[model samples]
Target: MGESLQSIVNLVDPYTLQILVNIGIAIVLALGLNVITGITGQLSLGHAAFMSIGAFTSAVITLRTGLPFSANLLLSGLITAFVGAAIGYPILRLTGDYLAICTLGFAEIVKVVFLNLDITNKALGLSVPPARSPIPMPIIVWVVAILSIIFVCFMKESRFGRALKAIRDDEIAAEAMGINIARYKVQSFAVGSFLAGVGGCLYAHFLSYINPSDFGFLKSVDILSMVVLGGLGSIAGTVFGASILAAAPEFLRFMSQYRMLVYGGLLVFLMVFRPNGLLGGINFTDLVLRAIGRKPATAEVNERHRK
Candidate 1:
């Protein structure tokens, strides 16, 4: 089945296939940010820094140690997670804008460090190996993306998730309930940063080149936009938003110089109408039934409970 799928994919135009792969990579990054900012309610702006670290780490591993791509992926994520824990420990206490400022500052520092690194060629960047997996690049990207979504969904339904939710909704109350706020916050960042590193692996492999400039402050803002556009705490929404934003530039290219203007306009329109997200709080089954002049039994039960 995998071979057949790969063969079918091989028939697609290379440029279009690369775009699809890009969408998958964006989804992974958005999901990671969703964990830190959405699920855990911690505002993080340094996500792109982690991605930069992952790309360099994996590329270096392959160039120096000649490790397989899979090992590089895992190792890169582990290394980034350790960095996240160490950095997260110091600044996790600040709330609101203060936390955001600290994270943004940290992101710039990482970028500057990468720029001066001899191994990275100091802004010249490094060439990365393409996907060396037994499976095709598209298939592997899809598998990783799907598995990430599933894992996050499951995590949201676990006891750890409940604690995170409480922390998000009411930090003081959560602490009163005996939740370890500091520990949980750091752990959440570690998990989120690990995923960001994995995403960097996919992204670097996709482009075959990466530099410090590639993961700058603007890149971090773009990622944060994906989460906000999708819906905070909404995994499916994040995927939806990432896919739309990823493809929007391609579709809007025909507008020439006005393309970005139109793109920004569209995001503003969506936020005005569906502030929660394009799919947040929406159940397809219930939506379809409502459109057909009927309602699902669960919908009726929920309405009754609300009353």
Candidate 2:
């Protein structure tokens, strides 16, 4: 019992805790992007750019001004959202391949700027201040997770979400119904970007490192893969997908050589066999309870139980 307690204590050390916190932040970032690209049917290949914006802005503010973490995070998110809205005004007007190309180009531009900027240290990377207290990681993770869940729930039930869905189903019909399509799209983009910015801020702090290469085209592709593999527009699926994708490489460390190749092949097979993804847009929680012969509420059972 003493040994076990010691082992558990070791696991709770500052570094390990920070890692878990960073993972939580990653989930938020991925989920926020998932909402925009997955549920709302917006295709942005430049999400990492927005993330960089948030990270750099937050880092600069926190490092230079010595502001509180909350203030830095909020300001960073807002700044990133503003940038997103500005970009959305023009880019959201394009659709299909046109939008994809534009976003990709935008991402490239951000990368170039980061690499060439004299003040950004030209790829040497920026270091964030060290965390102050023990259990900081857990505190940050819980805060970020709670905020993300709240925001997601708000968006899911809001009239805005319904409008976005309507537009996704058929933009022309949504517009015909007098929905302000452009406004909703831009709004979604800004909200999603803001969430991504928050995630980035957490990431920078956790790693205590920031670099242009961290937010590259491949990073965007991996994020998109998580959404698609999870199932477009499925919230529960996003969680499962993100967890799996994030942990896969680590879990398959034994595979060593062909780990990624195997992962890619499996993805291809999934696309062929289960295009909707492993969960089929179904919530894992609901599926688990159903498998054990429990339903949410059946009328016959309710009436008989009452008797």
TM-scores of all candidate predictions against the true structure: 0.88, 0.84
Residue 69 miss distance in model 1 (angstroms) = 1.7
Please give the lDDT score at residue 114 for candidate 2. 85
lDDT of each candidate versus the true structure: 0.86, 0.76
**Clashes by residue pair, model 2:** none
Clash number for model 2? 0
Cα deviation of 242 in candidate 1 (Å)?
Answer: 0.3
Off by over 4 Å in 1: 1-6, 254-267, 282-307
- Can you write out model 1's per-residue Cα lDDT over 69-163, one digit (the tens) per residue? 77888999999999999999989999889999999999999999999999988989999877666667777777888888877877876799879
Residue 54, model 1, lDDT: 87
For candidate 2, what is the TM-score?
A: 0.84
